[model samples]
Structure formats: structure tokens, C-alpha cells
Target: MTTADSSVDKGSVSAVVGDKLSGRVALVTGGTRGIGAAICGSLAAQGAAIAAGFSGNVTKAEGFLADFQGRFGTAVTIHQGNVASADDCRRVVAEVIEQHGRLDILVNNAGITIDKTILKLTDDDWHKVLDVNLSGAFFLSQAALAHMVERGSGRIINVSSVIGEMGNIGQANYAASKSGLFGLTKTFAREAAFLLERAGKLSDDSVGITVNTVTPGYTATEMVAAVPEKVLDKITAQIPLRRLGRPEEIARIVHFLAADASSYITGQVWAVNGGMDM
Candidate 1:
């Protein structure tokens, strides 16, 4: 029997706590700060056993773990690895399963953007963005899907950016990677459909999985902190809301997609841009 059909019994304590998630285990990549940390806290609050990841920033990861446990009264382990490495991605999924015994969600939120104009952009700069933003998501999703497929239920949410869809100056590489994530999301949704068929289920019935993408606009994250206040002000002036988005706002949408509420939504990108592109 597949893992889903096997019905491995969980401890009563876990069952009680997991009721909100109800047999769910989630891995949130790049979950140490900003939107990632907010997503981790939001999900953990709803009773999902979280395996949060960080590519660098060991100090941030430790602090996040402490805060998460203190607030939730449950320990959330932090995994450190470069998501750009395929082997490291596999190890991430492996560790999550070894610790939690099942995988139900994967949030591909780890990304980096190197800003350089096309006229001055180096091949290294281009590949670096693609490696972290696109390739990292690709590898992690591939490895995580193995466990999700066996369980016959999963949710994969890829975090993208508005610049990816609307295009931004000095961020060609970053835009390209985020744009690529859309294609990957669509492809994975199809693959998940096939797996659902193997599990004798239809899209509207049974425990098949769904994959989607969430794109956030200029949020008050560290990445945007590098921009000068004048430039940030100019940028905010164009936003209909007259301000940057909050990490918690984006985290709310992610929390929804990770839950059963979004099972019917897949292969689509939802932007939390506060009318910047609308």
C-alpha cells in the first residue's frame, strides 16, 4: 500500500495537536525571516509540524526557532542548506520525513535577486539568481514530491515576485527566475494529476495534491532595505495602497494555499501587490 493507504498511526498527542492540519507535515524553505518566518509562524499556529529552512543567516535561523517555540510551545527544527544544490535539497526532504514521518506541504520560498542592468549584467549574476530562485525551487520540489507522491497528498507553493510578471529594471535575472517558476508550477500540477490517477482519484475527490504560486510585491523585507529611501518613496508613490506590503499579508495567502481551503487552486500565481500591477 502507498503511504497514504497504509494509515500509520500517530501518537495521541500529535493527533490532538495535528487536528488543525490533520496529518500534515510541511517544509518551508528560506523560512528564517521576513515572509518566510511569518509563514512558519502562521502555519505552526494552525497545528502543522514545521520544518523551517535557511540557506545562510545562521543567527537569524536560531532566533526564529526560539521565537517559534516560545510562541507556539512546540519546537520547530531549523535546517540549513543551499537550496541551489540538488543533493542538499534531497537531504532537506529526507530530514523532514525522518523527523516527522510524512510530507504534506512544500513551500519553495528561498530566493535571491542580484540587481544589475542588462548592459552590465554578468553571466555569473544571471546564473546566481536562476540558481537560487529557479533551480533551487526546482530541486526542492522534485525531492519533496517523492514523499508527497507516495502519500498521495501534498501541497507545493512557490513564492514568486511581481517583478517577475511585470518586469523590473536592473533585475532581469530575478525576473527571469520568477517567471520560470510559473512554468514549473504548471508542469508540476500536471504531474501531480497523473499521480492522482495512479492513486484512483479524481481532482475533485480523494487525496491528490495541488501546486500553486504566490507572488509578492515590494514588501518591507531586507532585500528592499538596500534601496534608498528616496527611491523607495518614488516606488511607493506608484502603489495604489501608498505603502509596501507587510510580510504577514503575504504569509496569510500562503497559509491559505497550504491548507485544504486551496485544494482546488493549482497552477496559478496569486499576487499580493496591493494594486501595484492591477
Candidate 2:
């Protein structure tokens, strides 16, 4: 079925077409594949200009950018950078603002995983996972917040994982990073709310911002493709839905939170895991 007809394709949060996000710009880290790419495509379809940030993988980034521009006729830009690096995060966001003039949405979706017992997991493994998964989000959000605060409006969506909420067998590093992300989300939400409240108290007419997180379950992404088929089947059997979720499903939620529909929601974690741990 076309995405238009599928239940998963709820499309944009905008009730009207063509101008739901008429003047908004969004940046998604690691937006070249899997859920990240899906969020970009979905947001573009909703009329938002999109900027995609990637650590490497120029080929995939270019291809997706072309596909998005061709399909939706929206301007889509791809940026190459190490999200774990504070400098790179600033560069990516600065370029986007230079091109589009403002930043409205930021999704911290780039992450990595190393599966091994703590006994075997090296310091390198632990640090790498935390660096990409947790630190990347912190740095990018910090940079983006500066712009959003200046504009007096924005949305930040951090992509966490169900594993972070309910610990997995051999994902100590991944779990810690994700759990930290939840904490980060809370702090961001509190800070944004406080800033907006203070602005309101001062009787300023300014657009406000919201921050939230989405934790996805086992999806058919490249990372999960690396798992053994038997392992995949075993994992699927544990989900209440008896299946894996599509990237688009998670993307829809991200888009909603990015849009005005979720203006009242923040500091929350939405789990798209098909009841995997429930």
C-alpha cells in the first residue's frame, strides 16, 4: 500500500495540506537511513524544509536527498559531520540557519550499539556507545537551543530506545546512554518551559518551544539486520503485536511532536515498541 493509505502513514500533524509547516526548518542527525531517513521524508512530505546531518556515508546521504527533493519538491540539504563532536554540531546547525534562516526542529537520532557482556565490553566500546548515543544529543541540543531560544520557538526530539527503559541482556552501554537521554529530555523541557514562562511573565510576544523523546522497539533497520535470523525471530515473538514496527511508524510520532499538534507536550518519552516490554 502507498504510505498515504497505510495506518502508519498518518502524514503530518498539520490538518491542512501544503502549509502545515509552511515556514519551519528541521535538522535530523544521522538522517541518512532507518528511522532517521524516515523522519526526514515524512517531515518533507508535510511541507517542512529539512537539513540532514550525517557523520559519513556520503553516498546514502546524497541518494536520500535526491529522492526527497524529487518526490516532495522541498529543499533538502545534507550535512556531513561527527555529531559526537561539539564543533561539528555547531557547524551543521549554523549551515542550516545560514541556508534556511531559522531552526524549528532538531532530532537527535544518530546512535551506535556494541553488544557484549560488561566483562567483555572494553572501555572503548562503552565510551563509543555513550559518545554517539548520549553525548551527541547533548551537544547538538545545546547548540540548537541557542538558536531556538533566540528565535523564541523550537522543537527538540531525541530518539532513545526501549532498551533504555527496560534493560536488555548485553546492552549496558546502550542502556546507560538512553537512560541519560531521558534525563536530558527532562532538563531541556524544564529549561525551555522556564524560558518561555519568563518571557510570558515579561509580557513578550514570542513563539514557545517543546522538547520530547521517542523510544523505538525492534525495527527493520540496518542495525537490526545485522542480528541473526533466529535471534530476530525470537525477539519478534516477545512483542505483543507479533511483529516489528516500521520506521515510518516511529517517524509519524516524531513529526507530530515536531509540529504544533504537540505544543503542549514535552519532557515525555513515547515508546513505539509494539508492546515489546509491556
Candidate 3:
């Protein structure tokens, strides 16, 4: 798709294009593929240097970087670490800062799910989901905030799900973890505001660091590709649009949040669910 129609631009860069994110740096977790990859591309197209974080799949990560470079004529650093691990989260943030000198945007897009009824869910299953989906975002945000607070500007975009707001069957752990992000978003926004105030930088006219969440409905990602055809059909039927969401569509919303234009938006949840949830 054309850049005007889609979040990503597939054509080669022919002329110098002035971008809103020029000279900025961004880090996107789980960015090797799917929705995360789209976010990386979108941000890069807008002239931000990108650091793509992935937990595993070295081959896929390399391919994504190569494709991104080809599309944008710029290389993206690949950071491989499990965001669920506090140490890894710290290391990831440090590496980004060391490489880019500063981080202007952070997208907490890494996540996983173990779909099972609570009755059938094992202890490992519950803990693993929460650790990755909920705790990971908290850990990474805390690590990134150290620099962001000092700079008095930053953007933190958390990727939540419609399931977080509207519950779904067989997703107790997943739902709870995503739901926790809403609280985290609000709390972080307040804390950032307080920090700005303490620094004597708070103003009624200007915005400090912004924190928000993006809830995506059923999207056509690799994870969802695993769903049985019959189950997928049922999911599509529930959507008023009668179709699944696209990763690029969600990425575009994230791009907007990461831009300077969205400075006035914070502690808000932007839903890109195609009318799946009001």
C-alpha cells in the first residue's frame, strides 16, 4: 500500500523527506514481526532512528531489519532480550541509550498469551502471562523513565487489547495482564506530571512526558493466524466491520501517539478495534 493509504511506505526514499520525528530515537519491543514490526516501520518512515527489540527468533529479526533498511535506507538496531526479566529490561534500556544517546519514544508492544480457562490454567501459565504482559511493561517503563524524566520529554505507548476492557473466554490471565496496563498508564502519567512539577517545569500550556495505551481488537497477526478457521469466523462476525484489523492500522495510531502532535494526549486509551468494542 502507498504511504498515504497505509502506515508503512514500501517505496525507496528518493528525495530528502522532512519528518515530524526527525532526529528522534525510538525503541519498540517485540518488533521483529507482526504488529510490532509495523510500528517500527511506521516510526522509521517518519525519520526516527529505531531500535527493534525481540525476545527470540534471530532469523526473523535479521530479516525484519534487512527489510526495514531496504525500505527506509536506514538500519535499525536489534535488541534481543526477554522484557519479562527485570535485568533484561534494564539492559535493553541502557543499550538503547548507549547506542542512540537518548530515547525519545518507547513502545511497550511485547506480549504473549496462554489461552485457557482459569480452571484449566496452570500456575506457570498464569505467572508467565502476567510477567510478560504486565510486569514487563512496568519494568521497561521504569527503566526508560530515568532518562525521559531528566530530558522532560518522552512518549510511552503501551499496547493493550480489547480483551482487557471487554472480557473474553479462555483468556483470564491475558485479560488481567492487559487490564493492568490501563492502571499503569494512568499512574505513570500522573507520576511524570509530578516529576515535571518538582523540576519547576510544569506549565499549563506545555505537556511533559506523555503515557497512553492502544487497545487493538482482533488483528491479522501471526498469533491470531493460529486460531482455528471456525473460531476466526466467529470473531469476525462479532465485529461490526465484519473483518479483522490490520497490524498497520494499529501501527498508525501508535505513530500518532509517538509524534509531537499528540503532546496534549496522555492517560488515554485509543481503541483501534473497528467497532468491535465501543
Estimate the TM-score for candidate 2: 0.91
Off by over 4 Å in 3: 1-18, 204-207
**Candidate 2 per-residue C-alpha lDDT over 192-269 given as tens digits, one digit per residue, 9 for 90 to 100:** 878767766312344478899999999999999999999999999999999989999999999889877677788999
Tens digits of lDDT, candidate 3, 1-278: 00111133435464214487877889899988999998887887788888989987888887877676666744468899998899999999999898778999999999999999979999999999999999999999999888898888899999999999998999999999999999999999999888988988777766479999999999999999999999999999999999999998998999899988898899999999989999
Stretches of candidate 2 off by over 4 Å are 1-18, 200-207
| C-alpha lDDT of all candidate models, in order | 0.82, 0.84, 0.87
Task: Give residue 241's lDDT in candidate 2 (0 to 100).
Answer: 97
Q: Which scores greater on lDDT, model 1 or model 3? A: 3
Over the full model, what C-alpha lDDT does candidate 2 score relative to the true structure?
0.84
Cα deviation of 21, candidate 3, in Å: 0.8
Per-residue lDDT, model 1, residue 58, is: 78
Give candidates' CA RMSD values in order: 5.4, 5.6, 4.6
Q: Give the TM-score of candidate 1.
A: 0.91
